[model samples]
Target: MKAIANALIVTIASASSALAASGAAADEGGFLAPLFLAFGAAIIAFQAIPAVMLLGSMVKGFFSKKAEAGANAR
Candidate 1:
């Protein structure tokens, strides 16, 4: 448990430093700014695919239950 706690603290500290470094990049005046923006946009676009699939699956499940119930009644 003590080792796990130490590891967690180290991970958090390193992550915070990395975030600070990324923030510093913005102050350097447009070096690869467009590339970073495009990367961020692409990340968001890729994430949307799984979300849409989950929504479609949920809708399919909902209607399939209704269809099954209707057929069973007949």
Candidate 2:
């Protein structure tokens, strides 16, 4: 229990002493960040349409009967 209390105190002290950089020291992703993010989102959206259609057809096929088998055998 004493070791646990010491560890907790150390954690609290380290957390309080940590600070973020001020002003010019901050990191930036530059002007192209939003453009890259938008492009990625658009790519995902375009890919999703075909994926949804394919999944829908697959699910429909699973629940559907193979009635065409008998007709084709004729």
Candidate 3:
């Protein structure tokens, strides 16, 4: 069962890669490519804000816990 699952995943990956390789054409919408790239970058930048906030909160919580533990030991 695991062998069959692995084979299926490999087949799907190769088929998709082949399809993607054939689909690209040099003459197809050069201007739209940069616009789409900028849009994707903007989306990533917008999503990063929450991730940064979460990391900051996690660091703050970690330090507070250490401080509390030290106070209790004294």
Give each model a TM-score: 0.47, 0.56, 0.49
* Segments of candidate 2 deviating more than 4 angstroms: 1-25, 68-70
Candidate 3 lDDT by residue in tens digits, 28-66: 677988899999999999999999999999998888735
**Of the candidates shown, which would achieve the greatest lDDT relative to the real structure?**
3
Residue 26 of model 1, lDDT score: 52
The digit string of per-residue lDDT tens for model 1 on 15-46 reads 99788776655565566978898999999999
Superposition error at 61 for model 3 (Å): 0.5
By the TM-score metric, which is better: model 1 or model 2?
2
Q: Kindly indicate the candidate among 1 and 3 with the higher TM-score.
A: 3
* CA lDDT, every model vs. true structure: 0.86, 0.86, 0.88
Per-model root-mean-square deviation over C-alphas? 10.7, 4.5, 10.8
